[model samples]
Target: MELLEGNESRCQNMFWMNKDVFIRLCDELENIYKVKGSQRISVAEKLGMFLYTLGEGAGNRNVQERFQHFGKTVSRYFSGMLNVVCDMTKEFIKPSDPKFKSIPPEILGDYRYMPHFKDCIGAIDGVHVRATISPSNQVPYIGRKGIPTHNIMAVCNFDMQFTFACAGWEGTAHDTRIFQSAIHNLALKFPKPPNEYPQMKWYLGPYKCQRYHLPEFRRGAQPTGYKEIFNHAHSSIRSVIERTFGV
Candidate 1:
């Protein structure tokens, strides 16, 4: 209760989100998703406990101590909260413009990308997230990172909000493998723009085997030819996904 009623910074430090956002999230979970507070604990406390575990990487015992609940109570609420949040993904993580009718404000306002990248809706990339698995099942999950990880493929808009995410591929799985699976699976509802703009692709990528990253072009030789120039711009726009993951 103290954390919930405390100052903004305290709430953010503990929950990784502002107090108002946390309250709004709880309200959404209750009103929209039909998540109810248990007889002993409120929804806010349940969410706080879950977020605390994620933010601090705390174990069940740590959660029990912090929330002053029994180990079983902590574990139960944590699992419940996780399931509820997962259910919220389809509602929350989707494109602002599903039809891709309007040009993104980021592309429209910036002259560098205005005319060229107006068709680009978002960027896609994969990131490696560490996974916890049994020792017997660890080999398939170990890849170039040399750790048990899941390759999470995500698409983000220019504003850096995730529009779609597909997870569960092992670390050794290729990005193309995950992407193919996502697009092929009708249930995943992978975002595919309308075919009105047949002249250009809905998504763009830098030229393969070319200098693509911004930093490389920055320190070394400047982009010269048309392909290099185009790659630079493509890389610049695509960097939003990298920044989103970085945050």
Candidate 2:
């Protein structure tokens, strides 16, 4: 760091911050975060290496050698670093709840959304995530796809942004069940309490409730207006989730 500050640093060694930042961060872990364990290399070193891997995914041995350490598997480093990073970063990266607002009659013309999708609050759908189960269960766990594992329930909006995701549900679970689960598990910070997830806040503008309401979605024959409306909204939101993983 001192050499770099003096303007004598070379391009090859300019990544000195990677080391310095790592050390300082490790100091944070030890002093501020209070991780009480003896380690040869500081938490900073492992962290720097982890950040570097994010830029360029590498094999375990490859990363270990770059860190100037030995016998540390990439698996161990990934497990530790990600566990901490996810815990620290999820609140910031994930999307907040949805809301219900009115839409402008001018924008909708006769239908909704001038010509595009109008009054469409959002779309919601569920997905399947394959898991690696044991021998016997693997066969059944593989839904219609004939693969392995179960399904993950995910939801999104008409604009194609994903608002929520619920993984690890069995494939046999219903879409409404997945919708209910997503709402129940949703963080309450962005939403008002009375209803689980935030309702659309506007009837016009961006807040108009434009749900995807697929025809096949409400299969059980509940036949209620609100249930149908919610199912449609969930369906629309779910369409986005489907397209997301498709990429």
List, residue by residue over 136-235, the lDDT tens digit for candidate 1. Answer: 9999999999999999999999999999999888999999889878877789998877773534345566788889889999999989998999999998
The model with the greatest TM-score is 1
- Which lDDT value does model 2 have at 157? 44
Candidate lDDT scores, in order, read 0.89, 0.52
The TM-score, computed over Cα atoms with residue i paired to residue i, of candidate 1 is 0.89
Candidate 2's residue-wise lDDT over 68-175, tens digit each? 656455567667877776555444434443453543343355342344444444444456665656687665566677777456654444445555455666666666
lDDT over C-alpha atoms for residue 91 of model 1? 88
Compute the lDDT of residue 65 as modeled in candidate 1.
Answer: 90
